[model samples]
Target chain A: MTEPAVTGTGTGTRAAPKLVLDNVVKDFSTRRRKTVRAIDGIDIEVGDGEIVCLVGASGCGKSTLLNIVAGLEQPTSGRVTIDGETIVGPGPDRGMVFQSYSLYPWRTVSENVAFGLECIGMPRKDRAERVQELLGIIGLARFADNHPKELSGGMRQRVAIARALAPEPDILLLDEPFGALDAQTRRAMQEFLLLVWQRTRATILFVTHDIEEAILLATRIYVLSSHPGRIVEEITVPFGANRGPSVLRDPRFLDLRDEIQELLTTQVER
Target chain B: MTDTSLQPVPGSGPRTRSGTGASNLGDDPAAPWRRTAKSGSRGRKQGVLFRLRDEIPLRHRILLAVIGVASIFVFWLLAATLWSSGNVLVPTPLAAWKAFIDYWQSGELSTDLWASLVRVAEGYALSMAVGIVLGVAIGSFRSVEAFWESPIGFLRYIPATALTPLFLLWLGIDETPKIALIIAGTVFYNILMIADVTRAVPRELITASYTLGASRLRVLTRVILPHSLPGIIDVGRINLAAAWLMLVVAELLAAQNGLGYRLVQLQRFHQVDGMFAILLIFAVIGICSDLALRGLRTLVAPWARP
Candidate 1:
């Protein structure tokens, strides 16, 4: 109903944003010759090293939006650019982690992490080193020789994250990475992700349905309305660095969580 | 010091020393109940034979299998001796064994076995090489599938047996026709089955590989092929039976030497015992090869196994 917000460069004084989605729209055509727009007229800018979260109800096309950013699916009409370059197809510049933890089951943990490097023709010695370093970072060094099937759900997701980070992509795109985990594990993973972000300082565009999770992890949150998905609100979190579970108890966090929850419920009622 | 030595060790209680210290077994309070529990478990282990979906011990399984095979032989013996009334038409077990020994002593068994095996190997190996390439292509690429779909659909229906006369006409009575017949019988099925297996690879794996900076070729070679390997072996295993059937058909129709040719000659001379021996050999070879392929599957694609 209104023009989506097109924010300026970033929180910092950078000349250009790290990632940009301009007037992004995606439509699917049914076999009966009817058109259904999944997401419409979206515009967003994620700064360098920023953890942005897109929050919405189911069928709000949040995952679709992430896929568009990952370049796995093309937008019906729009442009997505990273560092002033338009993305034509999937490349190593963007890393993706799906909710399903899409690790190659046949390969061991280290080999799965080394896949991208192998794709780029990296030397065996260097690939092994990078894979080892990542295994240590994920606290899964002991599981380096095990296959994906041998790991628990949380460990597999961690390996998936390490795999996406293997190529050292300019940005990380995670589509509800912990959506399948139990609530307790999800909270732990949230904390673990913050630590990983703090360590890698990688730019992230995260999607999730949990409002509190968005509030906890995101620098800025985008809330989308369902049934022809569209962004209705953008809230920039007011928090300093060094985030932890303690932030969940912060009074400011409570206020922001309520506000986003109300906004989502109103969208559902409409 | 002498009194301490006479006393039982402190940590080594009655239960620990009960097996060697017979006097402790009667003194221990829990010994009766523990013995009952152990006997109960032993009873349950014996009941495993009748329990639904329970695992049998390896030795028991082997014993059962031997009984199964022996029962078949017993039935054959009854049919030959009782029903036929001393006639050699059905050939008793001893008669077939004698025929087997005679053939082995004359070295005809090895020669015929080698001849049939080599033809099947060459034909099946060629089919596997060609089938895998074509199957992967057809499964991976839409255009390749489209181009080959209709022709293969029409050709597979026309039985390979119907083409034997044409094969002999085109390639003559030499080994060429026999080998060609085996290939014709199996290659089509291999291509279709393997294509189905390759198509079953998860789409997300391919997408994930692409995002990881892999090219199309690398994705096929590293991801799809490895993922589909177990199913491919299964397909190869199944189609090998068809290859053997075609080999026999080719040899039966025309051949200088092979198990199938030997069977034809034995039949003409009314050597029913020799025929039974050859058929037994065929069954044994078929089963052994099927098991070998299964082993190969486990070796190459351990991830596919449970």
Candidate 2:
């Protein structure tokens, strides 16, 4: 692993990488003893407060890369670091939002938000106050007493997001967050996520297979290639001043989308 | 509509006694008398019988009761008719009831019932402790599972009572042998049940805990144990009945005060009614044990019940 080049002095406060992946590789063995390389020699550095989206089609190792950073899985080689320190395991610094809305079924919405805090042995009063704050911010104050099973799909995802954000993690890792929802719900969630990011300014590594979603939300998009996934392209989009869903209609955005589509289609065919 | 206006013809509101040309019978002190008057004219109603019919859910309870009652009545009727025709194998219902009550009063029934319950409690506790520990060990490790797989499978297939002679030889014809027999019969079933269920726990849940900075020991303690508890309690319910069956079988071979021994003694004395009484006790014990185990399972593993 090479040290990331030290660039200009970071503006204002303390310095941190936020998240870094150094030459991470992963290989999975099926029952027949055949090995498939899921991620190969991936290295990337995401700065504090940066929203980096990993965009790719199916089996391109987008999810596998995110799982490695979340500490849900170990890479076959290399290391992942956060805040200039090697990540030993998952901690309160990096909170994960799974695509399945994996809210604890036995717990109410408020209790689900309190799970991470409880695991850290936070004081009861503080835990309750934090949960209340998150529920209010997520616009689920009225549904706090209900279990996950009783909520609609969109509402459940909100609760899941609230649960992941309850501990105030510096980095939020969302794995295809709105992938499980209907199109209308997906758009609603996308707007909700932008609102949340604006409010907290948390660094996010969002993984999605949808090109439009990446173009809509991401500050910079990293495109991944299939068949032993490696970075094929990195595009920096210029959203002049106003950044929102309307940015998708920009001519430059469409041109970039077409180029990425051609690149991804070529990789898939190969 | 005309029907809406005609709906209030009899009484509009609470009636007052000051005579507003309204039916004031409700406010009158003679209301009870009027109610009784209607009842008398309508023929006396069987309120108690009606309430009784409504209190119990007839579809379920009545069906069960009818089957039970019919079987007992038919058995007794057949016994009576057979005896009258000079066949004396089975006693009549009245005769059995008389003998059952008399024998119960002799203090022998209470002693045997107490003895059997105590033995079951002791043997079951021991077997549960051994079964859960071994089951968890085997279920958690692939190496341990592989080593014991064949031997345990073979042992489980062999009836535990077949080892009764060996237990008797080793522990003598005492309470120890009988209790040993009971434990042997039950522990194998519990081990296999617990291990099988424990092994089926979702691998994702375990991996999730581990990735959340939980150590291997912590993962086992916090995730695996809680997840497997419902399965363990389920197996416990099944093994409770098995333990009782083994206990009665064990006691049937010994010389002591147990329900099974009492039945055997009554058989020797040609006390067919007394034997039937002991058999009834056995049936009651089995049903009560099953119900008690089910209640315990529901209480401890509430999440298992949806």
Candidate 3:
């Protein structure tokens, strides 16, 4: 499989496109049965191991698109595929970490991280080892026995990420995962997410309304426009990979931040 | 909400020239909100007011409760025996105590207590089993709810006491009828409460589990059941009261060896002091059982603390 030609300043997308959204459309009916088009015809493919972000305003339905990909919601039209196979529903191949962290309040940190492993029927010994490794990486090993209520918002979200990755899915879907955190914690979590991505190499599809965040983490950005939401622009981030928080100070990062900001502000005719 | 620990307390240190540090504070837009970060307000939690209830020491609380109970007892003794000397209805605390000792010496108190406790155990256990199974099933499945919701709701409105004649006619004056009465009283109340809790289990947690590759059954077991655990205990705790309330109704008609029977028997003899003694016993039993349930709740769901 060849990489799609870089229409933006992005580097070459290599190997297979692990996730694909083809001609996706979603409609919602109100209490009065009035159909509101949440998403319009949209086609995008995530290259193998690529970090792709769908950035848009509130009504743009970026979350709806992510939900469809996660198999939590079915698209009104078109299909979503991962590794050339169509997804019918949520499976272990796609692990999702929601904005709410969604860590089981009843489970301790280690148990929450081991949840998917438990669901997939991993042996208890192996699951324990895997959970321990994940806890150490996310810096929650010391607090592994603590329940979600005992954890701060950021710590709970780190557990959420670790829990999502515990299943070792081919793709990780994060729906504004750091949205609830304070600014400092959100920044740290972004850095932590990159570290997790580097270790796991799972293809990520992160959805966010924050442009700066999209620029900081995403390899390629899909800017979605609202009012019958559709992709308005696709940007190839030139800052490349193996980045740290220092990359935020780069001129290219500033330019890209401004560029996405401009696209979001102005109405571009389709 | 301010981080008052970082703020210097007024008069704690020699005052510095105000304009000297004005330029440094000028750069921060949020510095104005920190003005309330006085030392006096340090470590104050948001949304909670300082109350006499909060500041009262625990030992004092216990002492105050004991004093309150003694005061009531003294008042009863004064009004019943001293002030109204010949009023038989007004049993003094000493007379009630004497009646309690008389019943205990006869061993009838222990027998009644044992009988009442056995019925509670049998009927309450049955209710718990049926309530949890049907509550979780009904709450998780729309079809199950559709099937059972209306009937359960309809039965809930009809007081368990109203079914006395039916229970007596069907099962006769036996332990089975009394147990059935208690079961009927507690089950549906528990079902509706537990089902509400199951339904209120967050949609997001369920979806998160599904994406983690959990089968429907796994989600039900690992997520739904455990999440609803505290609620189940809460239902049991609440329904314990309902269970005891029905205890009297169940024993009212033909209960030979229960606390309710002892109460009715004492009343027939116009032994007002004995009735008061039995009422005190009921209070103790009810309170002790409620405390036991609360202990069980703490043991079952260690994380759900107030």
lDDT of 1 at A161: 93
lDDT of 2: 0.76
lDDT of each residue in B1-306, candidate 1, tens digit only: 143444545336544554654343334565555342331112223364775787888999999999999999889988887756434579888899999999999999999999999999999999998899999989999899999999999999999999999999999998999999999999999999989999998887888898899999999999999998999999999999999999999999999999999999999988998999999999999999999999999998898897
- The CAPRI classification for model 2 reads as incorrect
The better-scoring model by TM-score among 2 and 3 is 3
Q: Candidates' interface RMSDs, in order?
A: 0.7, 3.1, 0.8
Model 1: residues >4 Å from true position, as ranges?
A1-16, B1-67, B85-88
| Residue range with the least summed lDDT across 10 consecutive positions in model 2 chain B | B35-44
Clashing pairs in 1: none
Candidate 3 residue pairs that clash = none
Query: Per-candidate TM vs. native?
Result: 0.86, 0.76, 0.87
User: Which residue ranges in model 3 land beyond 4 Å of their true spot?
Assistant: A1-11, A267-270, B1-71, B82-88
* lDDT for each residue of candidate 3 in A1-270, tens digit (9 for 90 to 100): 112333333345554677889999999999998999999999998986678999998889989998899898999999899877888898877889899869888788998999899888999999999999889989989999999999899999999988988888888899999999999999999999888766666679999988889988888899999988999899988766578888899999999999888888874443
By DockQ, the candidates rank as 3, 1, 2
DockQ (CA atoms), all models: 0.57, 0.13, 0.65
Model 3 over residues B31-63: C-alpha lDDT tens digits? 555443333333435443345455566877788
